[model samples]
Target: MTTQAADAAGSDKLDSGVLKVAGVVVLGAIMSILDITVVSVALPTFQRDFNATYATVAWTMTAYTLALATVIPITGWAADRFGTKRLYLLSLTLFVGGSVLCSVAWDIGPLIVFRALQGLGGGMLMPLGMTIMTRAAGPDRVGRVMAVLGVPMLLGPIGGPILGGWLIEAAGWHWIFLINLPIGVIAFVLSLRILPKDKPQPSESFDFLGMLLLSPGLALFLYGVSSVPGEGTVAAGKVLIPALIGLALLVSFVLHALRKEHALIDLGLFKNRNLTISTTTLSLFTVAFMGAMLLLPSYFLQVRGETTLHAGLLIAPQGLGAMLTMPMAGRLTDRIGPGKLVLPGIVLIALGMSAFTQVTADSSYVLLLGALFVSGLGMGMTMMPIMSAALASLTHQQVARGSTMMNIIQQTAGSIGTAVMSVILTNQVLNSPEATAYSAVTQGQVPASQVAPAVLDQGQSSLADAFGHTYTIAVVLLALCLIPAFFLPRKRIEKAPDATDEALPVAVGMH
Candidate 1:
């Protein structure tokens, strides 16, 4: 915020101008986070309308994620060099443009390409939002500001599918992308009026090599995750081998970063005791969270013989659970520290996933809802503390890299979670022995025409005995998350900036 640097210089007040800016950023954050899940409900419709395979339709989501992961490491420099306002506005423009382009796409190929562009824009919003909120509220007020920001973060994914399901059924898939236009337009216009202008300051050289290694590494890794479902064992290896290669590149990037004067992402952030532990827990949590999330819809669609809207609606309770309890969790983390609260939250998540064990062809919907709510509550309680703890550990100067690293890990884990689950679910679904044995257990009497769709849940019911298999795996993930909560300290913690850390202006990044 070098342009407004003079205005904001040396002042840590949390009143008037700063608070107003914070409100606007929150609105923008909602737009960014909500868009990620809003597309979930729309995916079924997109596949049907485009006459494409599930593999092709998935990129509408996957490409957006890949694009975001690829570009986020560079954001600190982009913000530092371009000023938050300029970069923020540009990100808004690009997102809005991508949304409009996505609405007009004639085929799966073009739509996915366009969505990646949208992700390119959307990815910057959260980090930028964090930068703005943190800088405005200052260090002392970070917890409360983050708690407020958590609303959209938790709400977007929780509500996205149901909202998109209703919208797609009522209107069409195209409207999903079209919905972004007006909101984006208003955000763009208001941004010009209110966002602080920070001029680019000359500083360290951009680490082209680190980024080069990191980007393709992430791209290939996600690509492999997406490809795993379709490529059966032989075909799966074709995709996985490249994924291994991609990881090797990331390892090379780490080595390259360790040796550099300034890396794309500063490896030094990891040396902080709390940062290391917090991020480790976060990655595990994401794997469990995302793996369960990915599994639930497949359960409904395949085993339950539900419509897309029906399947989407059934999953709403998880989000409901999260929204209901997250604020309390955030405030609790602030008051009691993350340690006391997170363990119970992880325990709740295990309970919630256990509830899934009861789900079968004839399982009660009401019971499923209860389980999801508890699961959501647990995730709600767990995610924010880990994040708050991590953020609490960082100085304003290190916040950008810290946030990117967290985001990257969460994203990567999500990709891996779904892939691993897919392998489990798919292998079971396809095996004639398991499939036939499952089919024979309860509903063996049905004719082929009477058979439920080979979707995840219906497939399970067609073979009713396999429900425990998936849930068992989910429980292991939940327990794994709980085990690490021990590393968190028991009281509200201080992030005393290290003496060795280089000092820089930790200005708010606005666009």
Candidate 2:
């Protein structure tokens, strides 16, 4: 063959390899994301089944979130110490085992405990998957590959509730956890066959002190934030005490990281302009987006008087819009850069949130659905591109650490958003002029059916106003995210070969 023909053949082999790696990794990613959202929809069912109080049963989610936060700081070191492929498989095994236990759980306490084990596995899957894919794709193709990997993130939230509701109504709640078994098994088997072997970095040492400080710190902080929704105020002891301790420990870890040559995660990565800006943008956008997501369901179920399954279906359009735009956004990010796409995306998200601010109790379904669709489109355009740009900014050696830090920030931001929005919505509801009147109607002095029309109208309007205020806050937060997007690089930087890539087989062992 001529020289040109040889180059074309090699290029085809490279493209094929990228797709295979992305496919296997995405299966694991989908399982983790699906499990999180799916379990959420079943919380009420669990409460009834286990005969547990709301406070106790709530730990099913709280434990998982805290465990996930605690384990994330250590993933970078673990990935480097063990091989990435090996660690990825181990995470899947732990997750699958936890799911099995959860399926058979006899009570709330056992289920919560098992969910934490599941979180440990789920936590590592995301950052490790990203690190593996980033290294495999090389920086040049990071944009397109990250976009492909992002499909699970986009689809999971949209599909999880719909699927969970169907399973619970048609099959049973056990099916929610049991369903993960087959997917996890298939992903594990495929990964072992398809993933390239990564040689462990023996020179890397574990930072025991850093781990002790950071892990608990993250857990406590997330726990404190999680308490806000239940407690109704950050001033409550449950929220205040843990948050302060968590802050102190986190500060100490930062100081320790700065001093150590090889810390758990290199805080020094902040020096990279592209990475710092991208991280900030991602965190702010997540805060705004997550808060709105929490509020939307309550609006549908409580104010609009929709059923659980119906509310889940209502949210589908947003995810659909995001799914539609992501591939195009990914290509654009690679061709130009994140800057152009992310700016417009943020603006579009803000516009969508803005629409919610004007919503009334009787707003049209078509109007709300259109707004959600636009917001989803904006999310698709923004999230993966920023992720792609952040990973692209790091050298191959820095991919593991960079991926971990990004996940940590995103998780914290989500917790903060949830907590903040919960507080705001609760306060609005309590302080509304209709609160006392609504309380009287619910006190059983009169049947809801016989309550005066005026009283019913006031209650619905109050709830709608409370939700609208929460959405207004979300819009403002999303608009603020644009500031960081300005600082992202206009084009992706070409990556140089690193020592870590030396042990990998050609085309990452593609057949």
Worst lDDT window (10 residues) for model 1? Answer: 499-508
For 359-461, candidate 2 gives per-residue lDDT tens digits of: 8889999999999999988988999999988887677778899999999999999989988998898888889757435544543335677667787898888
| Weakest lDDT window of 10 consecutive positions for candidate 2 | 499-508
Best candidate (score: TM-score): 2
- Per-model CA lDDT versus the true structure: 0.74, 0.84
Structural similarity to truth (TM-score) of each candidate: 0.88, 0.94
TM-score of 1: 0.88
Misplaced by over 4 Å in model 2 are: 1-14, 433-453, 496-507
Model 1 spans with C-alpha error above 4 angstroms: 1-19, 199-202, 234-237, 432-467, 498-511
lDDT of 1: 0.74
